[model samples]
Target: MKFLIAIALLSLSSCAVHHHHHYPDAPQTSAEPEYGNTDELYADEQDYVDDDEEPDSPAVAYPEDMPEEEAEPTTHQPEYPQYEPEETRTANQPKVPSVLQNCDVENFETGWIVAKCGSAELFVQTGPAARGSYYELSNFAATYATMVTNQETAYWGKRSAISVNGARGESTEYQFRAMKPGLFGGGTVDKDGEIIAHGIFTTAKTQHGKAGMLCLTYGSADKASCQRYFNALGKDLKELGRKNGPVMVGGVALRSEGKCHFLRPRELACSNGSLTWQGGSRQALENLVETTIAKWTDDHGIAGFYNPHLVTKCTIAGQTSTCHEVRFQGVMSTPAEIRHATLLEHQSLAVMCTYSTQESAPPPCTKFFGKS
Candidate 1:
């Protein structure tokens, strides 16, 4: 048994030495079967990773001779870029000027005023003052212009003049006919006394014989913009006058002079004397006056009005009309009593309000409905 085991060991030793000496190296080939070349395979895998992003996991160990059936392409997901918050992105941006924030309508035939604002241009027009006629105001403006431009004439060579008798009903129009090119005739000043806008003005009379003044102004001297505005003047003024169609409030036909020249149209605020008017198509409560008070207080930016109590509730021309007596305690002025009237019809609401500080007299809320 010992001799047989020693013979078997010698045979195994001989086989091992023979196998080590006679075994052939791997055959060289032009094409690697998937991953035959370790250096070339690692380079191909590295190409998949983005230059900016590192792989999240450790480098994979690929077999030098991986089977073709098991081989697959490495996929490296590209990292997405991170962004700052919107507020952070805009932190250095400038705030809008307050003059551009609100439109003020103090003197105008129409209560409607609109503003066309842009990066290079701003055009605002006050329809007409309530008391002046075209003839008087135009003459006055011409006289004022002659006086003001007297000094500028030395450099500009000619003073600006208004074409008063050209056409009676023509829209407030202006030609870029200043004696010098790029010269503005007149302009509006900001609170800081900076001339922020230049004017292209025209004067005309409304259908009611009210003088209408249209001042189309611009911050930039772009001729294309000026011509565009000149073309749109007729349509814009017509719409401002509410001549687009009749605006019936509580069955009473009311004429809008134009949007309030000073107030933004979105605010829906209009005022005449002590009375304020706000109109909307949204269905308002016929019985509830809280909505009216809340909107008025918010829109007008006045101190909160309190002690609201119903003074009158009646039907006017098939629509429910209500009047509320509300008081406004002022800081410096006398504590004024206000009368708020809400005229409600189907899907329309017209809130007309008036105030009186005179304690000896009844609140003038009743007269406001008629005037409005």
Candidate 2:
């Protein structure tokens, strides 16, 4: 029995030795997939231990050639350039009065005074001051004009007259009433005083004249330019008197006393805005146009202005206006004129046609001053 026990013990010892020989270099690690070599396993374990042990200095790999960063761009602006309307004036010229910006235009058929200055039909509205916006220099070719009327003789049907305020000693009695900014005779008397750049006769000063005047408005009246131009044209202007005088309008001679001179028709161009014609009758609203908006009621007639210019060989309502042209012979020193406008008289409203000497008139002012 003792000998049998010794054999069992020997067999157990041999089995234990064999198991140890098979895995002689294997690591005794708690981690799964243990390394085959104990030396390699120790080195890997040391690297992981170093990362946890030193928090301040990490062992991260970095490249040698890393590029530097660029700065972002900035945004800024420069200051310069400012402007004013007065720049249009020159050193030699005296500044004229600026035009009033108080124009409210609706219709010329009512609340107005119409002055039939033998040669021209002028419409004027006094007092009832309105406020408006000022503009830069507008040319004579502009369709509208702002007029400063003298309260005394410049009123309706009194025959245009102006009593010079500063030039009391000179006593320049003007025959025409209204004036655009620039045309003051040759030069001016008081170097600084506003000059009487151009002489305008008030053929009519109706309240509703705002319609026509508003239609002709521009950004600037440019009195300086008008004065320069008037001096260049060199036409003789006088306060039309009761006496008879000869004025050459066309090739034919026309009778006049005030001898009111007109601006060069060609220069009368440039407009800031335009008017829309609200239809009415030519004959029905004719009289009403003298005093009110042309609404076709039983008592009123269509208020239509005689075309300031005479147009021949033109068509209206698809027919020639030359046939409708009426020439007055006997009326002494009366204002006769022509127009190139078409009227839809059958309706309740009469629309005024757009007319200006600035360019080729739509129908063209073929005839002017009632001349053949």
Candidate 3:
């Protein structure tokens, strides 16, 4: 029994020592997954076009602080303004003659004045400086007949020199002469008792007292009515509703005027006057405009005679679009006029289609207005 027990104990000790030696403490590595997520990421399958298939608009970059989910996409289009019918209002000075209401004192700087009163319209122009004697008043006689009574110059034979008063009671003497006789006579609308007289004078009595020419025309149902014109010419004209001072009214900018009030570019103002709108987009508008311009340039623009404007455009600040005008070479007369007939998305879009001469191609109207 002792021998058998000793042999068993030796065997047990050998087996235990061998097992301990075989299992040395190498670095313990876990083939089993850790408690945390794996370092390697497997991407979900996505459908993407090749780099060459990108759209025209450049990609917009979002701020680094913005989250990928919260960032706006590059495919978004910016909003732009649109056009609506312009509302018209009657002139504030409705009782004033249409002519006087339309003619501002500033207009005198341009060498002409056009005004209207009750049943009468006055068109005044300053002629060239006279050597010594006043001018023949080239259009005077005809103009007088049109303004006062419809009698011709042949009807006024009575002549006289007279002093006329202005709007401010300042006395300006004029050389009144007879153009035709019997215009106001015998209580007749066109007889001698109904006399008509015409004169030419130089006065600094223009808008803001600027120097300009004055043509006088006076008529009366009788001598008493005629005398009032000579006594208080300015007062009578003012009481007739002529302008008293320079006004903000707009009109032709003649060469002498030396400045222009070009119409402004159309704007994209909303009813609340805000320039932007949510979800507003301009891609479609831009496409339509591009197509129209292309078609126009192909058909009529090269000739400088554009088709009637399909749209009305104005010039305004901060706008970026092509807007222009041209001085077409008028044959004998340069029409003393600037044509306001261009379709504009912005003042920058105003382009003069042609050079001054009909023979010349369109000059760089685009460049001139661009600087504006």
| Candidate lDDT values, in order | 0.29, 0.19, 0.24
Instruction: Write down the TM-score for model 3.
Output: 0.27
lDDT against true structure, model 1: 0.29
Candidate number of the best lDDT: 1
Query: What's the number of clashes in each of the models?
Result: 15, 58, 45
Question: Can you tell me which runs of candidate 1 are displaced by over 4 Å?
Answer: 1-131, 134-160, 164-196, 205-218, 221-248, 253-274, 281-308, 329-335, 359-372
Tens digits of per-residue lDDT for model 2 on 236-325? 111111111222211212221011111111111112101122233355434433322212111122244222233346443343333222
Q: Candidate order by TM-score, highest to lowest? A: 1, 3, 2
Off by over 4 Å in 3: 1-90, 94-120, 124-162, 166-207, 210-340, 343-372
Q: Which candidate leads the pack in TM-score?
A: 1
The segments of candidate 2 whose C-alpha lies over 4 angstroms from its true place after superposition are 1-137, 140-143, 148-284, 288-323, 326-342, 347-372
**What is the C-alpha lDDT profile of model 1 across 155-247, one tens digit per residue?**
001113344334323222321212221223322111122232343444433332233333434334453444344334333343233222222
